[model samples]
Target: MSGDHFHVHGPHDHAVEHAGHGGDDFASQIAVMTAILATVGALFSYQGGATQNDAMLHKNQAAILKTEAANQWAYYQSKGNKQNMAELGAVLTSDEHRNKFEDDVARYKAEKEEIKKKAEALEEKVKAEDELSEASMHVHHRWAQAMTAIQIAISLAAITLLTRKKWLKYGAWGTAAFGAALAALAIAHI
Candidate 1:
């Protein structure tokens, strides 16, 4: 290992060879990665908004169903003295309450028909909220799928950009952050 024109051997570092375009490619990669991450972030925000809207809708719907159920029970309880209890089936399943039950059923059916009409008119009624919330959850899930595609693409591109083994592993960690955020939001709804 003489100092006079000595030769030393190690890994043939390609760093210098690719170093010429490294900065350019790195910038390009960073720009693309930024765009993808921004898109994912925007989608996450959108999903959050959707979830809020859906939760409000569900709360409203639960209230309406609760009210309707209470009203229905009250109607049965309001069987007054003006109409003989025997003629108006006090007990729904009593065999002796046949004719009265039939009469009460007809009246109840009429009320139901009226309620159906009202419901149809008020499309925004809270009655159908649970169904709407269930639907929102599905949409959120699909949105997450779309977001996943972006995450995957970003990760692959990041891997390609990262030559260092340490950075390569770290890239995966960064990519997973988006998925973890989306999962957290989704589980909140559940």
Candidate 2:
């Protein structure tokens, strides 16, 4: 040992020595368990966020299409330059004007059809969005269930190391109850 508190790597990796019932085995186990839990939680959370975002984007697209439909309907009804006659229920005053008005009304009708199609498409997109969000919610529920189990497992390990009070005896029953509830929720979604 250095007298001035100099640090040194312990015997070709201290972690290897700690993976058992002696030396720092408990410390090594804690470190490995912590890393595993962190990775799983992060993966689950990312998936949940991505699915939720997809749902929101679809809702926004639907709203935009609805607005466009309203705008087209309004534009097709304005006066002066004609085309509004059919929509306004006003017959033309002469044959020439009537023929031109018929053409104009036909064009606007076609444009309105295009807008109607877009709105219908938007409705389908929104429905798909809803389904995606619901699926994400299901994933989130599963993550929560897994988290509860992980927490109990970690706690039991800690208590066993600290107090030697038969960790499973304290942790198992609560773990089962929560696990069953989570399983029920997951099955309900199915």
RMSD of each: 10.8, 7.6
Task: State the lDDT of candidate 1 residue by residue for 109-133, as single tens digits.
Answer: 6665665555454444554676677
Q: How well does candidate 2 score on lDDT at residue 72? A: 51
* Candidate closest to the true structure, highest lDDT: 1
Question: Largest TM-score belongs to which candidate?
Answer: 2
lDDT digits (tens) for residues 34-102 of candidate 2: 466456545544544664565566556656655765665455444223446563543735655666667
Local distance difference test values of all predictions, in order: 0.60, 0.58
TM-score against truth, every candidate: 0.45, 0.56
Cα lDDT for residue 126, model 2? 58
